[model samples]
Structures are given as structure tokens and as C-alpha cells.
Target: IHSDRGSHYRWPGWLDRINGSGLIRSMSRKGCSSDNAACEGFFGRVKNEMYYGRNWAGTSLEDFMCFLDRYIRWYNEKRIKISLGAMSPVKYREHLGVTT
Candidate 1:
């Protein structure tokens, strides 16, 4: 997981949990916003598009996970981006003959 160099992320408890899960911890250098800009931007878009001001009360953890998964899929597959010439990322890739 990537994050800023925060004390919470450096805590032994958090370190142990991340290690146990076999996920590598990645932290941006102090004062380096560029390193985190892409991730931060994606999360900002996610909150704006699906999270902010939404009523999520009574939603189970599993249900919320499913909803998030679906949203990500739709975002990647169907949502149009003017930056991508009015195409979804997947479509843009295909348009450029990118098989992967």
C-alpha cells in the first residue's frame, strides 16, 4: 500500500498487519507530493463520483465491496474521458491497438 510517511503507517501494529498480509508498504518521501499525486487524484475522483454525500447506511461490508468493485469496472470500461478523446480507457487502449 502506498501512502505518505505518516506516523500511523510507521506504527508497529500497522507494519505488522501489512507484513502479515504480504503487501509491500510504499511511502512517498517527505515533501514529495508528485509521488502521490496520481493515487490521490484517483481517490479524489472516486469520492466525487461515488462516495461523497451518498447514503451508505445499512450497507454491509460485503455489499459495499461489491458496489465498489462494480463502480471500478464501470469507471474503466464505460466512463468516457475527454482526455482519452471521449473514450473509456479500455476503448482508448483498443483504439491504439494495445492488446494488453
Candidate 2:
């Protein structure tokens, strides 16, 4: 997993958990949001295409939560990702037969 050096991400025990998992840990260089541009872009698209467009304009928090849940499910299950060769995240993972 990659993260900026924010305090939440840079907690002392964070490295221990990552190292314990045998997966490599990586960080973006300070002040370089471009290093994490893919994630930033994904969130930008989510907000622009779904979230911000209807943000908090509903009847109640329950309704808003329902909208967010549905949007997230659709985003993961149907929205095509440019980086994933236009496949949804779920489709990409299932094609690879990954358990996680």
C-alpha cells in the first residue's frame, strides 16, 4: 500500500504491520501528490460523476447513505477503469481469480 507521510499513515507501528504481511510498503515522496495521482483521480471521478453532483441534497441521512452505498457498489462492480483496461474493479479481480 502507498500513502503520503501524513501522521495517520506514518504512525510508528504502521511499518511493523506492513512488514509482517510480507508485502512491500511504499510511500510517495513528500509534497508530490502526483505520485498518488491514480487514487486522487479515481476519487475525483467518483465525486464528479456521483458524489458531489447530488451531495447532501436528499431527504435524509438514510437516503444519502443508501445513495452512497449503491454508487460505491456500482463503481466497484460496473464502472470501467481506464487503468484496468476498461474493466470494473470486481471484474478485473474476478478475472484474475483473486480471493481478496
**Cα lDDT, all candidates:** 0.91, 0.79
- Clashes (backbone N, CA, C under 3 Å), per candidate, total 0, 0
What is candidate 1's CA lDDT for residue 42? 85
lDDT of 1 at 30: 82
Kindly report which residue stretches of model 1 are placed more than 4 angstroms away from their true locations once superposed.
none
TM-score list, all predictions: 0.90, 0.51
Q: Give me candidate 1's TM-score against the actual structure.
A: 0.90
lDDT of 1 by residue, 9-78 (tens): 8899999999999999888888889989988998899999898888999999999999899999998788
Pairs of colliding residues, candidate 2: none
Count backbone clashes in candidate 2: 0
